[model samples]
Target: MNRRVLVPAAVLLSSLSFPLTITGASVALPDLTGDLNASPTAAQWVVTGYNLCFAAFLAFGGSLADLLGRRRLYAVGVSAFLLGSAWCAVAGDVGGLVAARLVAGVGAAIATATGQSSLASAFDGAARARVFGALGTVLGIGLAFGPTVSGFLVDLAGWRAVFWVPAVLAGLALLLCPALPPGRGSGQRVDWAGGALFTFGLGALIWVFVEAPVLGVAHPAVLAVVVAAVAGVAGFVRVERRAAAPMFDLALLGDRAFLGYALVAAAMMGLLVPLLVYLPSYFIDVVGVDPARAGLWMLVLTVPSVLLPGVGAALAKRSPRLLSTGAVLLASVGVVGLVGIGPDGAPWPALLLTGVGVGLTTGVVDGLALSSVPADRVGAAAGLFNTARLTAETVALAAAGSALTLLGGGQPDSGFTDALRVVVVVLGCAGVAAGLGAHALLRRVGR
Candidate 1:
């Protein structure tokens, strides 16, 4: 294969593997819970642990790519991920699995932080858009297929089979490693203190979000974590201001276009990520669908995601503001349409619409964010953008899980339905806000 074809193929494979695990694991979670005798909270951690670690390490991973060569770190990340997947397959308990997932999440962080930057470095202008579109297409396929594949594996082999599949795919990615372009280290000093502070601070904050629903927000443990989070984050900002080279360029936050794109991406994930995490369970628990069938049903969401990225890229070229605003509004409509979904309701319509909205907006926002910054800082920009998006995903999952627990009271089924409704409403409102915000920001930029 030519270098152009070979590098993007490798990058996409490496990048798509993590998301496959994310959605696939969600499908496998119920089985894992039963086999491992996990409590609800513990089972939730199987997903949360991955998101938490991935989010925490993203910026650092990107910085590492800039400082240590993208291809080198990409290989390291894939190798670590393969090891983690193997560990998860053999793990005997929920705690062990969650721990293994944390390792895998670190690998995911490194791969994700570098994947787009590498592409940005290799391609420019229209080619960049096409590459991004292709990436989006791959992302859609991975997400679309993940649950169905996991469902079949679980039925035929077991939950462990899910981990094995990704491990195998990652191993293949390793073979293509030589295709990746060589990058010299930037030779800049990394702000270790700032990185540590930000990591701990974000960890503490996520802990509050994850634990607060179980432990009341007013509980002493929660209160203490909140204090630590505030202190750590505040200290991180202070440290960054003084550091010779900060992990994140705080100055980027001032760019209206960048900020707007970041917010839209964050909001999109806030709704979509949790839905992907929880929807499988809903199909099995509430609608009485078999795992395999439920997986097929999820295609309602994944199909549009697969098909729309190119269209989104085209629209973005014409008018990003219109692309973003229209996409968000469409997403809000889709979410709103989901408000009263019940055992008797048809899931495909609402899910397909939401997927279209999310899919379109995601492609455009991704391209916009990459274009918003200077080419040299692509790694840092990718890290910052993804960090925001994944952090929102983590928080959304925690909040949604909490709502299901608290509001469901004694009737677990009913409570879950209620929680889904609440989440849909909130996300719908957020989508509307994002749409309006994008219009305003783009208008200002145009002026």
Candidate 2:
């Protein structure tokens, strides 16, 4: 096999490490708490802090990749993640754990922001699409199996094993960074004000959500968070509109193709990842299953991860445009399945539909998001894409948390009806929008 072909493979393997770390850590949370003597509320911050940093910095991380060069930044990112993982392994308390998670999140953001951009640079036409499909499989596998993976490691060796794995993987990726492209920024200012506003706003919003279940909605902390997330997001948008060489070129919005593509991403990512995140929660918290057993029942979701990409790949090869549109619509159908299921039921079939929906959407989203971008702007596009999806995810998580609080939390069979209703309605709307978006992209691209 050609060494040139092997290069992208190497880059991808390195990229996989960060996402694995994310999922692994979440599953290990129960164990982490006992060792560190953390409160349930505080232990949740280990995940929240990573999310806070990751969501805020994604767009900026892309800018850094553009300004510095993907390879150099990749090395920096992977190395930082490794160090942070080690820091997490040895952290003495909640404060220290949160700090390590924050750092780890920054490093992970770099990987998330640049991985697709790097691949686009490495391949073209059909090959680029194929690479993304494979990337999707890696993503699906990592996400779907995170709890299981973390559960295994945590049970066998300990939760610390989860931290150890990423450190080693990141270290290896750092060693292989030399083969990537040299830096190619377009001489733009870094948009610090925009970054700060985004960071502060999102951070506040997340603080509100993660804390809300523990701190009642009436609590000052919750109120302040709600207020700040709104204000910060608005200020960031205003600043971005004024910035010279904005961190995210909102001008991409003017390109109807980019706009349509991004909205689809926002909705799909916003809905899909969180649905998966909370699925196990639904099983354990609602269905009254064992935590370990609840993870195995997720086999419904995990099995699709192994097989669906190949099916999606075949569809894309035949008609990338319509297939992406159609795949998006399938998510709506899945949402309906969830909404229609009874509170008296196990939701097994509904969850299976959700898995299929996720399978259909992931590959299609990957294709449309990357394929629609002009090659010259691949890095910028990737960065912007990551920002949009992360923003969507942040919103989804916040909404899910808020909705559950309002609905009176307990079993998916009981409390999740309203929550699932919200998920279905919003996701259904998102699906329609994404289908039309793909059609628009196809028309604009003259595919």
Candidate 3:
């Protein structure tokens, strides 16, 4: 009931909405394709556009919040997101839908950029941990619930309903901002030039990666995009080094522990997001389940993901290295189990373990990422963490599309095996790295 708690309470809603929309759309895309008259390639953009923009601008969003007032930006972002969702809900065609998704992504970046800073500005060590724990729970649940929730909405009301849910949440966040404390930023100059360069660079790179599957990696458009992306990055780096106040302080990467945490987050995302991306494909194509039914099965995988964080949060406080151990163990076991899955169809229990593993890793990873950085640098830490994770997310989603195209075996069984194997190997390696990271930080953050 305290306004202090109300801040994260409101912020958590925004965090929850991010993944819900991200994962929810994947499950609903099948229906969306038909209703919107979209092609397979265009459907990919529905998800890609959101993530591309989310990653491109998230760091800048954080800096902007620090420069501008958090309250002002939160209101701005939530309103924009709400308005975008309205557009998506009534979008008439694939082009309209993709554009709406891009708009929604911009809104999400605003909310995410400021959400953690607001929480940190409002709370301290132990309380911060608890709020973060709850945020983890919210994230896990949003992702876990997205498929099932979207499925129900799509089945009962239509795909448009999925867009409306997050829209309403954003609108409520806008209303609750008045109850929150005043923001601390003094409206410093935002690195618009730096932000523009980074946006163009990252966007171009993802554009190429996303199109590779459909366009052929060797296609002229793909090559051109890749070139533009590289040039964009070079330009961004040069620009940032000279900017009055760069959007991202590349110097932050000089902090070994901080960079390690960011990499782990990236690796964790690379490991899990891909698995989730491909699972829907298996449910629909291999299992021959309809979109609604496939979504239900996918939700089964996410249930543990939704709840494990609450447990992991408590454990993380008890042992700085505890979640790291569990992250490695769960991911290994889950991926190894997946390696044995065959064309006959996956066993239900194996599927469940995979989801459990995902939840375990995500929860612990989130906790460590924030805890490892200095208190004053939570903004940089949170921004770097989100950027790395979002990059992995964009990669994972695009890679699945690319992997399937290359490994084309005409069956979801073959596709699933191919995709899961790569993810399993990747996560297995990440688990080891996370363990090393925990060990390195064990003495640093000394219990």
Evaluated with TM-score, which candidate comes out highest?
Answer: 1
TM-score of each: 0.91, 0.80, 0.85
Tens digit of per-residue lDDT, candidate 3, span 1-447: 678867987898878778878776877776777788776667778878888888887877777787878888887777778887889889999999899889889989988877776787788889987887777678777888788788778778988888889888887777788766668788688888888998898788777766677778899999888889899889988998888777776776766656655655565566566666666656666666666776777766678776675565666677645555555556555655666655555666766766665666665665576666677876656666677779777866676555554565324456656765665555566556665664564445434
TM-score, prediction 1: 0.91
Instruction: Give the range where candidate 3 is weakest over 10 consecutive residues by summed lDDT.
Output: 404-413
Tens digits of per-residue lDDT for model 1 on 1-447? 898988788888877788888987888887788889987777777888889888888888877887899889888888888888889999999999989998999988887767667787888899987897688777778877888877788778988998988888888888988888877689767778888998798778777766777789899999999999999999999998887888877777887888888877887787787788878877777777777787888878767777777788788888887777778788777887788777764456778888898888756687688798888876567767878888888878777766665666313376778777887888788778877987777775532
- lDDT string for model 2 (1-447, tens) is 464565576566766776677667656665566678876556656766776678888787777776777777777777777888889988888789889989998888876666656776878889886776677767767777766766667667877888888788777777666766655765555778988898898888777776777778899878877888899989989998988777876766777666666776676666565565555555555555545665577667556756676676676677666556666666656655676644343456766765675575565655556666677766567667777777777767656655554564523456566675666666667667766766776664433
Clashes of 1: 1
Ranking by TM-score: 1, 3, 2
Question: Quick one: ranking by lDDT, best first?
Answer: 1, 3, 2
- Best prediction by lDDT: 1
What's the lDDT for candidate 3? 0.72
For lDDT, candidate 1 versus 2, the one ahead is 1
lDDT of all predictions, in order shown? Answer: 0.80, 0.69, 0.72
> Which sections of candidate 2 miss by over 4 Å?
1-6, 33-40, 114-134, 179-188, 212-225, 282-292, 313-329, 332-345, 373-378, 402-447
- What is candidate 3's CA lDDT for residue 108? 90
